[model samples]
Target: MTDEPRRRGAARTDELLRVTLETAAEVGYAGLNVEAVARRAGVGKHTIYRRWPTMAALLLDALSRVWTTDLDYHDTGDIRADLREQFLRSAPALAAPPIGPVYRAVIAEAQADEALRATLHDRFLRTVEESTLARIKRAQEAGELVSGVDLTFPAEVLCGTLYYRHLLSTRAVDETAVDALLDMFMAAYGT
Candidate 1:
């Protein structure tokens, strides 16, 4: 009997997350609200409020569910190739709908909201940066990169440049751009 309620709750949570993504895709972050989600989800406002304290929190959870790409690099022995592969795989998703637009919206809102900014960093940016740093560190240990250097800045630059181009510039994060970025990184850090 208890299992039935738990299963239903899980299903409802999934439905809510789906509706949240759909709503965000249609109306964007500025147009999104708890009431809107509740209406679209066919649930009372209290239901959503019980799960998430705020719209940003709900959006964050929704984004997390959809953006489930491993973000971890494959140890293909070649650092440049590994980085390139990861970037090429992820760049398209970042440039497309659902994940892309929703993420951009959160980022825009984060600019004005300190708490959201911190939450966004804690939930998303930090994960990407850490994964990137771990990959770079592995390469350095293998002597593919320069020795005894702090890779944190380079990792941020790599990830941040792509994000900046995607969110702030006109450039597409295409294969050519990825190759160019890899070339630059290799030249600067390669042993």
Candidate 2:
């Protein structure tokens, strides 16, 4: 009812983001084009440009939406069990065909672009850190974690391992790896 142009503009921007992710996965980040995204999204080229000025900016926006952040970690009063649970939850997305490539591309891009780095930090890295912080804080209060153990360090160690393994090795995160990691964390943190 109020300002139909603005409403359609917002809808077009959303559509463009969705289509850009699809195209990036299919064609790779280097191959992304504004025209292709516009055609696929059924939005005009001007609409996309108005929303995102550059290709990299548009891709960053697309990656932000594509990576799901709806996950919430649980505290079972056991750190080891919680790590295993997070591992299982992440495995599926790690195994996703589009997710792996998109994550790799974003990581590679972040090295060269400051804005892209910020996008990754806000969209992906911060979310993981926040979830881990909550879980670790719970473990500490429950006395399941070791005394004087830095909570953030363990989360970084484990999640960093998974990220590198996924990006470089291109390997599917498996239950065995999860169990082995949990075993180490349990040995260090179990009280």
Candidate 3:
């Protein structure tokens, strides 16, 4: 294919992914299907299947496009403040339309699907954790981080708490919650 056709193809794929996430958010992963996504994207089911080859693959693509996996870590030399800011930045993304519900659905699906679990771990979770660990190391080098804490520690504690609030409860993951979460972690690690 020529460059123009290839560019249009990529654009169509992007649209398909956007529609996939939105449909999954609205109807849930359980309810999401190729038919729905194709219909919403205004494309044929063959188009989606041709791109993904499997439902899991399609979901992984959609998530990769929309999931906010990284923090806006500016390294202001205060790990605590930076982490707080990161979580504050994450709050809106968590509560944002499509992302929140889609994440909740995927999380629920991953609990039951081994393929999803492996894919999420391999692709999203590991990538985000490694990036975060690298950021943590930078903070450590600056003598602003707690010694001996692991990288997954923040993911297990802070992100865990935030996700709990996001999916399980009606309580909002607001600024107060973000501050409280940051405080809890800072106290734990003495950061």
The whole-model lDDT of each prediction reads 0.92, 0.76, 0.76
lDDT of 1 by residue, 18-61 (tens): 99999999999999999999898777999999999999999999
- Candidate order by decreasing TM-score: 1, 2, 3
Off by more than 4 A, model 2: 1-10
Cα RMSD, model 1? 3.1
Worst 10 residues of 2 by lDDT: 1-10
For all predictions, the C-alpha RMSD in Å is 3.1, 3.8, 3.8
**Residue 32 in model 3: shift from native, Å?**
1.0
Q: What is the per-residue lDDT of model 2 for residues 1-191, given as tens digits with 9 covering 90 to 100?
A: 54545447566667777788889888887677899898887667888888888888888777666667355777766677777888788777755755767767767767898987887788677778778777877888878777677778888877877777787786667888888877887777777
Backbone clashes, each candidate = 0, 0, 0
Q: Candidates 1 and 3: which is better by lDDT? A: 1
Q: Candidate 2 has what TM-score? A: 0.84
Ordered list by lDDT, greatest first: 1, 2, 3
> Least accurate stretch of 10 residues (summed lDDT) in model 1?
1-10
- Model 3 per-residue lDDT tens digits across residues 59-128: 8788778766465476887877777777677777767766777877887888999988898778766665
